[model samples]
Target: MDLPNTEAVGAIVALLLARTKRGDGMKPWVRLVVPLCIAVAWVHSPALAQQPAKDPRIGFLWSGVAEAAAVRMNAFLEGVRGALRAQGDHIELVARIADGNQARLPTLAAELVAGKVDVLFAAGPAAVRAARAASPSVPIVALDLETDPIEAGLIAGLSHPGGNLTGVFFDFPDFGAKWLQLLRDAAPKLSRLAVFWDPSTGPMQLKAVEAVAGSMDVHLSVIEVIDVGNIEEAFRTAAKQKVDGLLVLSSPIFGSSPAMIADLALRDRLPAIMLFPEFAQTGGLLAYGPNLIDLFRQSGTMTGKVLAGTAPADLPVERPARFQLIVNLRTARTLGLDIPPSLLIRADQVIE
Candidate 1:
């Protein structure tokens, strides 16, 4: 058998070592390994001539329901996987369910960074913030984050992330207007609207609620539930105030407790509008917002670009171009209200 060229192997190894050292900011002792690696490459070429290069390892750090709830989060993960598979990259997922535990994030971030993943998928704002804190150089694609990336200093702007982070923004503020409009249209006689949110998880939700509450001519009742234990108390207050309609703010907490909240609303016979279709389908009256599956698929597109050697900063942050409005006819019927035919026609989906 003809042996591979040792000189060529040495040259390739040396080139790789230089790039690695520069990128990793290695100390002198570690830097000395470059020469040693090249020497070994020259000597080992004959035996390792046909060895396949190890595929790059990518990591996914998911918050919310990508690992559990089996909602739109799962769709986003599948979409991201499909995109990376098209580009021939190997990916692995590490999920941490804070389950509303904000304190666990730093530890979770440490674990992913310790694994030395080539790239990362940060699934929500909390996960993204954690990943950013953990790794400064590794490329990150953020999915479903509901903050203004610029204001949060996650990116320089929508058009330029200007760092190792970039992906799609959920544009929560714009959706706030749409969500309020959906609420008003669903219950035209809505007098007082109670807004429910988890302060730890729903900053954008609260801001949006305040911004449009006045224009809709409905008295806004800001109900905050900082922990899982406070949810019932928050609802009791809403009920006592005789809130005509309830608008559940979009948040990781709401996403986590969709079934429970939906059931409570149905049992209480409250006319509720939400921001996700799955929430409305479970028992809430309606939902109006972007399709999370499509957003996740778009996140996959960004992952593909990063794996293809494009910098995360080079890929501009994307705003969802499409949105969806869904109404649950069963919930409408239970509430003893007739949904206008025009509204039904405008719905992307009407769950009967």
Candidate 2:
């Protein structure tokens, strides 16, 4: 029940005092009840009424277009909803999408911070960096596929972040080597390779590919693709170079357009491999990488923890719990390349 207002309590006490003063045969018990009533009114004062808690707002920063990121976003929302279900707390998401433009991330992140979000969720390394720069105190949960958080100095350590940032990060350098080996296993005669890279994602994947290309006796024609606009040109450059195969490196720009890249690879008859399983599923020859949807969901769950009063410093950094290898036999046949039985057997999914 709501407590009475100060004015109402004052009026009731004033009425009781007037009755006592009139002395119209009032019982001794009635006089005693006057002080008790005053004490009760004092205890239930309006000043001590409980205020309703404000709903928590989460800032979402993404480096890709909304349409391309829809599935992942849905998965993240599902995870957040599941985590907060027991608490019965409502969450409001304030999203800022870069729409495939890297330059706009910092401004978007700043805007989210300026809106006074309780927690921030950033996807991709660029978005994460921008969110960190925009706010030093706001807790951040990130989903980054191409960065080593430790090497990048985004956190003090993985086990205990020691700061206001924690998220799912992929160690792309070590994972990059696996892409080359898988491609080679599918196309044993691959001698010259074209590497489609995005500089914005960092040099880790490129360096890893370079380190292994020579040992495998393959010549590389590295093509730098800065945005979606440059993807077609990159493919054309690879075709002109007469490279035997293509290795598409990890980047939000490329990750957001798996279908386009896959179509280009098929059009150019280039046996290609990328870090997104959607690439192979869409038409590319092979894809081996962490499950992006699951990773985003994991980040969402962590964000819920931050919203539930746990400090970001106490939440440990995480990696993608699931990895997948997808192979498209139809794409291999179109390129006139034979995918080894050994590779096909190892794939988690094979599209005929």
Candidate 3:
């Protein structure tokens, strides 16, 4: 018969002796119950360690489906994902598409807040305004807007954005210079220039148009397109006015009708300048503006920084660093406009 080692046997006897002494000092049942209690507590310890931690949710709102807005949204989201990966943070986005109806923004903002999003990202002036009105405590990052944040009451000032709202400001007021230069390049003899804008949402944009138009010494005709249904009438008026060329503003109302506007300009054989490159793709003669996608990606950088614990207010509003000039050769040929070699060389994309 195999026998246990003397050392092991002695250890076992010692443990039994200790237990016997404890049982004698108390009751046998109490001695037996102590080990069971210790085992139960040890089994439950893991449940405490597995308690869930909080995850952050982000909210996004857009004014409309203009090509610029779409591109910017995509770029921003791509950046958001990249930033989250680098920071090891999990984020959920609550998004709403308002389609240029500023009036609908309040309801959308309310819904995001009700969903308890940790923060919000507003794309334009209308979205920023709605978000600001919805919650004063939740942080917001507004991107590529045409209006002054302070003027729109979205912030107290640019340096402080003075509340929970902060992000890139495209300084729409500066586009006046770029728009006029692009117009002159596309249509050298374009004596009469007609600007189509909305009086309600485009006053700030109009100010930009007027400032540059005045400086450029071009004949500026402002045709106000307020009702969305009356956009065709506005285009018809531009065509009837015998304007040498038409310059479109970067407004949601104008952007939503890009294909129609391109068709109108093409049908009329009028050289037109588009605010977004996709307009040139849709047949506008030329497009010269900031690469909206870059602006959006920049916004994502700010969002990532905020998520990483940097204060939004401490981050300065970024300006557009990269701009593009895209000329559509097909549209140019159809409009019978000869694009100068110099301008063509400067263009980022020359579409044939």
Cα-based TM-score, every candidate: 0.78, 0.84, 0.77
lDDT of 1 by residue, 40-74 (tens): 23443456655544455456565453234334434
Minimum summed lDDT over a 10-residue window in model 2 is located at 27-36
Q: Pick the candidate with the highest lDDT.
A: 2
Output the TM-score of candidate 3: 0.77
The reply for model 3, stretches above 4 Å from the true place, is 1-49, 66-72, 87-89, 150-160, 172-174, 200-202, 212-217, 226-230
Cα-based lDDT for every prediction: 0.68, 0.81, 0.69
> What order do you get sorting by lDDT, best first?
2, 3, 1
Q: Over the stretch 185-268, how does candidate 3's per-residue lDDT look in tens digits?
A: 877887788887765453777777777776667888889865346667877898778888888877655655677788888887
Report the candidate with higher lDDT, 1 versus 2. Answer: 2
Root-mean-square deviation of Cα positions for candidate 2 versus the true structure, in angstroms = 17.2
Tens-digit lDDT track of model 2 for 1-352: 6544443222121111121222433211101011111112233656675554666888888877656655766678767766675664445676767767778788879988998999999998889999999999999999888888889999999999999999888875877789999999998999999999888778999999999989999999999987778889998888889998999998888888999999988888888999888899999999999877788788888888888888989999988888899999998888888888888889999999
Q: What is the C-alpha RMSD of each candidate to the true structure, in Å?
A: 10.0, 17.2, 18.3
